[model samples]
Target: MIEQKVIINLTDENSNNLGTLTVSSIDCKNCNESRVRISNSLELINIPVVDSADNLTPIQYCPDIGANFANLMFLEETEYQILFESSDACASYDVLYSLTKLNENYFKQFRFSLGDNKTYKIAGTLNFRSYVGKSFLDIRKNKINSIKIPIEVRSKKMDYFNQYSSMIADLSHHALSLIFEVNSPLYQEFELDSKEKKTYYEDFMFLEYLFRNENLPSIFEYLSKNIHSQLKNRTEQVPLSLASNFNQNSLKNIVSKPNNLYKYDADFEIVHKLKGHIPQMIEQTKHDDTIDIPENRFVKYFFESIRDLIEKLLLSSDEGYIKDKLLFFSNEIEYYLSSNFFKQISPMDYVPFNSQILQKKEGYREIFKYFLMMEFSFRLSWDEINNQFKGFEKKLSELYEYWCYFRLLKVLNDLSITKVDFDDVFKVKKDNWSVSIKKGENSVKKFKFILYDNEIEVELFYNLRFSKNSKYESYSLAFKPDYTLLVKIGEHINYIHFDAKYRSELEIADYYNVFGKSDKKLNEEIDKRDSLEEKESIFKDGDIYKMHTYKDSILKTEGAYVLYPGNKTEQFFESDMIIPSVGAFSLTPGNDGVDENNLENFIREVLKTLLFKHGLINLNWKSLDK
Candidate 1:
């Protein structure tokens, strides 16, 4: 007698497990097994009975695990498989698709009960794939839509997510390191006023915590501080004065009589003759050197300047988070200055870069230099600051496109299928897909790469202006695509364009509808919709429509797609086969790397088709599958 058990892992379109099933050896052998189903309503039906047949292993059955099975999530077909062994032979099936949902807008609600009678609502897409007992399904909580597709595509999109998450971490670490290296000397200069200096130290640590993804210690306390406050404590150490020597009645420091009346104090402290009403004297008058105590005098100003510069150079744009930080530091500095501890520092109190005052106060020389560097060194204006902050997303989007380009390059390099002929390969390679990871500051406004050999030519353009010269003059407006790839093989050429979209699902859904309430209220609306409509798209119509316009209007274009941060099950979409089409690639990241994504497979498939079509490779194309 052989004893066996079968377990079916039920998952959604994104391959998130809805439930798990275990059956006995008798159920495995039964050819006409009872059908199990999970509807879009998340209702579980006809679950297999536990221990109907003899149990070989001391395995628990449905009575133990399936008692609370009503809460299983559902999107599409509930797939399962059989696993059994006898003395003679063992057997397994590829995949069994049983349960399914037919409606797209049907309501699906799965109640997951935690301890203490607490339950949570989860939104997900439906996905199906081959089962090999290896955990390939990884699902993330939906922030937009909940309709899942096949598992292979979902896995591919997960790859993009991993790559992006890793890149963001690297950039943040770089920023944090730069902040510490540039601001340490400036911090030490304020050692005379330790009370105020400590506030700066706290602010720096808070920024560090933000980078580390730790909870902020005092968020409300930090934001409540005033940014633009007046300085109060100050003293006039050196009084400014004026002097005169040739006055009659103002003879205060005269020790000798005048030698000549005409040539008064020129020749003689010795007297020759005294003229009528002649009185030789030196007079001096004093005045207070008053100043308004400039707003940018605190050590916090130094930190804010550095941060602003870093954001200007690297980040896409600050979402007023930096302003809140500035407020915290400004309030702390104002408090410190209001006290009797530190001397009031006016704008004139700041020593010039090469002033002899630096020689006298050597301790404050570094401090002066730090100030000069912060204010005068970069000369960044308010307009520039605003521009940099607003353009932060553009930079990040461009970086993602570059990441994709480099990944492709790596794959090509590994295959030894490409001989890259960069634009300036002969001299210095000026026009190429290049990344300048500069420390402290960096600029890449106009950057791109061009590749060519004897057979194939590839142009990877970044932020290429869509003007009349490029034949993209549709609306007489300036439009620059994030990334454009133009490939040429002999006489045949193909253009595939890509645009990086760093939008969340909620954002995409909101884009579909013009007017909306506050994000908080809109979120409530989205949650309610998720329970009702399981298969509806959470994507914005504009995003896909823009891609369609790109492919249709842009000259020499074959296809256009948007690479976004969505967790959709299907990695790619195509509306038409013959005409150029548009689609999207959900590349948002999760914690770990992709488990079994098909992004690589899809790229390979596309490449193989193009290679064969252009006669670049001459082999049995079908054999490439092997």
Candidate 2:
């Protein structure tokens, strides 16, 4: 066997060099077992087995060094790659790598042998140093004798962190854009005052014309038709003090100074009697931009509401670069709120003389519009935000699921067998992200499709409960599937289960043998192994296994299937009288609708079987019995 030596270059999260690790193969007699020992005191701190099964096998590209097999070592004089085995076979644990004490007495053994004095170098660089679990060996062989080898080591936890952080950034920017843009009616109304103030004379003339319109109340008729007409015919521009010509003292004496003079004692008695007979009325006025108006409160409230929401989202998230990005945006929001630009605007206040006038009031209507836009930004409703930030993360997944549900509904609607009646509950809260179906009310959480003409009911539930206990047994366990497409005809209920596996991954093999399998024969051997293994590893082991358990445990369930994101149309797996399928379809988001060919074809096939069973179609089904 070729003699091999490994050098692990440790780096920080930023890829800055910390130190290098070097371990030499130990002298062992076993031809199959390879042993190596680390002689440095500042080398590896610890080797943690992150997989729950504790089988730290090297991945396809990595060598079978002593790191994987307890009784073997790869002491070959060639380049190597280090990577961990597939995670599906192991019980899941935290995928974190912790740095351990790099002391002496670190001896390792592998089920291989090495020839003497051959200097084979296998180097790798692992990024991120939060040492908690075992690190895998990733390496490959190449003819180019490069001095340094570079490999990116990413933990699953970090992957999730990156994905989740991206989602938060996307939503934060969206919310901020909505808040800053002045296109909403509320902002437009606020701008109207500035425009009128810039050209008051022109605006007053326009207002005169507007007030004279037949749509206005009778109170403004004289101001429109009589006074406006008189002003318009004068050709000359009116003086700025035009209002000074009118005598206001007479009106004040009649309205504000009623008791200024009493001509006689009888006059005083009569005035007192008239005052006592007049009714006292208080006008309750509402306005936007006023200190006391609730609409004016929206300014500070808008800033405060979103600030609190983003802060909550930030606090709930794991502290990372993503959190820092959110913090930066939050600070930006604060700056915008406290800036002189926002402060210069005065609050709007007005009393509507007519009850319907507020709706016509541009400034007032704008305030309401602003309220709605802000509410939408925070996904806030009357009582709760309903975890709006988190909900946005699920938006893509939920959209796909809902599309699938509706697609199925359309199929049933098109069916000639039964007259379809479909009803769904879609509700949005007053100002929040508390948009959801009213649960516990006639299957509100699920899409209800009832065919009254044919006595068939099909209920498509979205993450709804199937049973509180196992359907196969009486165990008390809640079984909530992502979607339970239940079809009921007469007295029988048939269930076809589906789950949306958004992140199921297929394995990629290193056929080029960049990782030490340079020999053509050896490369072909590994390829053969991979091809055979593909049968058992078609889908993610955990996801496919969960589907099987769901199918077997659910009573009288016809078939259980998984809807994953991939290009393949479908893949079926048969197991012990139970046939569960794992299928793929392109359920991505775009301006256009979903690419429905793959999913639609599958649904059509299933419908054909159902229709035949119900005697709605003329096809024979004796083959189905087999």
Candidate 3:
């Protein structure tokens, strides 16, 4: 005797069941057998039989009765499988399944049909290498019942949710502010023409931020209440008999003839026959109070444009929270546009700088301010902005690289570093205010300070490249570190390079394990490498040896280090020498925020060594050349 039941199992990389799977039986009026649907066209056949309790046994026993949401914990870049089985043999069945990322634009679908088989298996690799968030798997049976399983994807490399997300958000926010601080030259070139302005990612981000702002609702309400109006005069034709007032120009239309006038008593006939002609119509001027001023027209145009933008974002966004917010803003804009106040205003072309009401009125003033900001947002085309940082949002490595740039800036600023020259740090290009830093360019920031009566000139470079064809040529091959700092005291100059590694210490440890060694042992071995080929191989693999490559290949390099988001900081030094060294520094974002003390202390130590301990340079520094 076979028991009527069905079972589905979800397993991890090792083919171990994550949890128990259960299914409930639905009654079929025409059939006595119980059936369960698994996935696309896949159904379980159950044969009913009566037997003694002692002799009866189930094919697969499940403690749970009905299907329930299962929690599946997934590691990024791992493989997993789903297995389906029934108590009895089934002729044919189809199954439909899909994995969808919650609130993100990612999904994968799978379909399978089995014939004359009681079991079926589906296998796939789940690669959330660059993302960590909530997702779900949906399995449908017979196209009637759906079983949804929730999945939590996590990164084995770093603290992706709290640390990575927070750091990226902070970096993106700062980058956005920098972009806003600059007025694009394109705006001046285009002459503020709407047709010429193109929307970019920054513009969308700004609009999203603007719509979510708490002050926006109050601004709209205030503008709606205190709308400005102007008196408009319009000319219309009216009958001559109905004209209340007549001027000399209007009176000329009536001919002066004796027969033209007819005098009669209250009910008597006319005394004289008709005249030659009489004017049938006259032009009259009418005055009306209209909210058709430039300010009002601009307000209408702004709302309409914003509403359209909201709709566009809505179509592109899949996140529930973001969609909800967009919908709310869209509805609010729609309501305002359809309101009596806005309906009274007529649509007109956006006339730049023609609104006194916007300039003087309190509510309109705020709208005008944002309108100007919006104009700046529109100046940069999407292609240009995208080219600046390709895949910035999707790739965590790219995001981490940019974040390190800004984070280092904050650290330097916190140390009271004063600018000696501002030309390369920040500048106005054409009409746009922008940071001077660009990938593959010599973006430098120079600072000077007096230490022990010696003037130290510090130059920090971002994404500085060294090549055979460049001024600072590499001895072996071209290599570009994320940041390079040069310190000049008198005639001697020292260079230190830093590379931002997105991999955490744990990942490095795992990589070393593949070679049957621990990270500490590998580091020791790396320091002992004598052959150039070994060093070149490690550098090609992009391990800690890359730091070695920087220190060895770049001329005058004192120290080369790795800046990673990890908990441990490892520093190594050459025998009897501190200046020539290689190490990794922990510079990760924490719950409270990034703790720069580790990196900051190391930098101060390096500066101390450079300034005070460099061959009596500090002792006679007062007499050294500037």
- Report model 2's TM-score to 2 decimal places: 0.38
What's the CA error at residue 305 for candidate 1, in Å? Answer: 20
Q: How far is candidate 2 from the true structure (C-alpha RMSD, Å)?
A: 19.9
Q: Estimated TM-score per prediction?
A: 0.32, 0.38, 0.53
lDDT of 2 by residue, 81-190 (tens): 32222212322211112111131111222334221233222223222221112223221122111122222222221122233233223332322232234442222322
Quality of model 1 by C-alpha lDDT: 0.36
Question: What are the candidates' C-alpha RMSDs?
Answer: 22.9, 19.9, 14.9
Error of 3 at 232 (Å): 22
Point out the higher-scoring one by lDDT: 1 or 3. Answer: 3
Candidate 2 ranges with C-alpha deviation above 4 Å: 1-294, 308-318, 335-341, 345-447, 459-483, 502-557, 571-582, 586-609, 617-626
Model 1 alpha-carbon drift over 4 Å, by segment: 1-167, 173-455, 467-479, 503-538, 569-581, 590-600, 617-623
* Candidate 3: count of backbone clashes, pairs at least 3 residues apart or interchain: 10
Write candidate 1's Cα lDDT for 95-192 as tens digits.
22221222222122233422132322233222222110111222222321223221111111223224433544433333223223333222223222
Candidate 3 local lDDT, 532-567, one digit each (tens): 312221221245667877898998898998776656
